[model samples]
Target: MAAWGSTLWLLLHWQVDLKSVLIYLAVLLMMHLYTGLFITAHDAMHGVVAPGNKKLNTFIGTVTAGLFAYNYYGRLYPKHHQHHRHVATDQDPDYHGGNFFLWFLSFARQYITVWQILLMAGTYHLLQHWFPLENIILFWMLPAVLATFQLFYFGTYLPHRGEHEPGNRHRSGTQRRNHVWAFLSCYFFGYHYEHHDKPYLPWWKLYQEKDRLLKENERV
Candidate 1:
């Protein structure tokens, strides 16, 4: 569904021009909205959003990620699960990846160097030249930038740091801030500690369980 939608939009966009900037902006917004839908598919694949529906969730995730040639379900699911089990602990794969600078730099390198930008650009050009349209570059460039931003910033990089429970550091205000950013940026993925403590809970419900556990611990 996502791939088809993107292809359809690209085809339509090939015919648009500078006179269609408003239309281009509208398409850009739609693409951004679809990026959120992609995230939901990702959550479903993790079984953190739709428990007991693994097959359905996996199918949706595959389709959504497939649009960008990303196979998160096939490649990253087990790895992500491992991260959850060892989260904030030294054993966590996500934590050892890097600090802030390495995180952002690595992300930029992967995102831009990956086939995302190239594939999108090629698709647009192919459609435009084969079909012959006006102001096609406008349609192509913005969507590419938007897709790049979505994948790099929102999808891969930010979500990783959402929950910071360093095994070395006991806990701090910085960790709390990290959680806030995680929730806001990655749709509550910032509750990494809670998710780690209770992996079976759905993503939406993880925070509730976290709070419950926190209260219970405090009373002790």
Candidate 2:
């Protein structure tokens, strides 16, 4: 959270050329951190953030979700559970398997609300008074939009894209054991089958679960 906030603050305040390669690096970093914000909220939804304290868990979820473009934790909680309950079906809000663009549209529509738009617009208007418009657009808005694509593609679309094997109860695909790429991509969420199989594991521990699963497969 501090990294995300501080990076955005510094980027927004810095007077640099938009065309600089540094700007591109900053955008990617911000996008990854923005994805982190959502992933943190996701952990909170599963009670991993504050396991014994529901109130604190919910508070963290609310703040993280809100920071990730004004998403409401109350609105997301039920829908996320529904996705787990009815994955890759018509009932799953996250599922729209045919075309990537079409599926992305459906997924976006589920979370994007009027209030979010209003809040973002209001924030943009207010921030422009102190920060450069280009900085706000590139550093703040563009990264968020890109982060959604990163989350949807690596986490959702790829994992649940095609038909599953008869024994694959979760109907999800796991990325190969490449922890570096996994974390860089979407906080190890690319290991989607492990995630579905053990939803309790936090993002940081996912790679450990991936290793365990690999050892089991080898022994079998």
Candidate 3:
């Protein structure tokens, strides 16, 4: 919440102009931060975030998720686990027969509803009086939208989309062999086979399993 609030402050107070190099740079930074918050909340959904302390973990999940545009963690907590259990099958909310755009839309449909959009719209109506619509779009709505796409592309589409490795139990895919490229793609979620295999690790710890993931893949 602190990260989001600080970003909001920047969007509202920082003078923004197309010509202002610094403001635009800050926008990019804010978008990245938004993505990070989303990822953190995702870790919480797996019960891997600050695990062993159920209240603290759920509290962190609820708060971080709410920061990501008031999402109800109660709704997401179950659905996300279902996604993992039913991945790549028609029952999976995140999969639409490997159709990229369709699955993306399906994924959105699973989480976003007409009422939620209306709520955000209504909230914007009230907030516009205080902050410019452009700033709200630039820092607030746009980043969340981009972060969703980034998440879908890296964490969903690339990993669980099509025909995965033939012997792989999870039917998941891994990204490029390069570590920097992997991390840059989606907080090391590019090592997705590792993730489905060990969803217990938080995003930051995903890299530590790289060597093991490769070794297992080679044997399979």
Tens-digit lDDT track of model 2 for 120-154? 99999999899999999989999999999999999
Deviation in angstroms for 46 in model 2?
A: 0.2
Could you give the candidate ranking by lDDT, starting with the highest? 2, 3, 1
* Candidate 2: regions farther than 4 A off: none
Off by over 4 Å in 1: 1-35, 48-50, 68-72, 85-93, 96-99, 107-118, 127-184, 217-220
lDDT of model 2 at residue 215?
Answer: 99
Relative to the unseen true structure, what is the C-alpha lDDT of residue 34 in candidate 1, on a scale of 0 to 100? 50
Going through the candidates in order, what is the number of backbone clashes in each? Answer: 1, 0, 0
- Write down the TM-score for model 1: 0.56
Error of 1 at 112 (Å): 7.8
In the range 136-218, model 1's lDDT, one tens digit per residue, is 44443555356545544553455455454556232211114344555545445455455445556655665576577678978
TM for candidate 3 is 0.90
Where does model 3 exceed 4 Å of error? Answer: 215-220
Best by TM-score: 2
Quick one: ranking by TM-score, best first?
Answer: 2, 3, 1
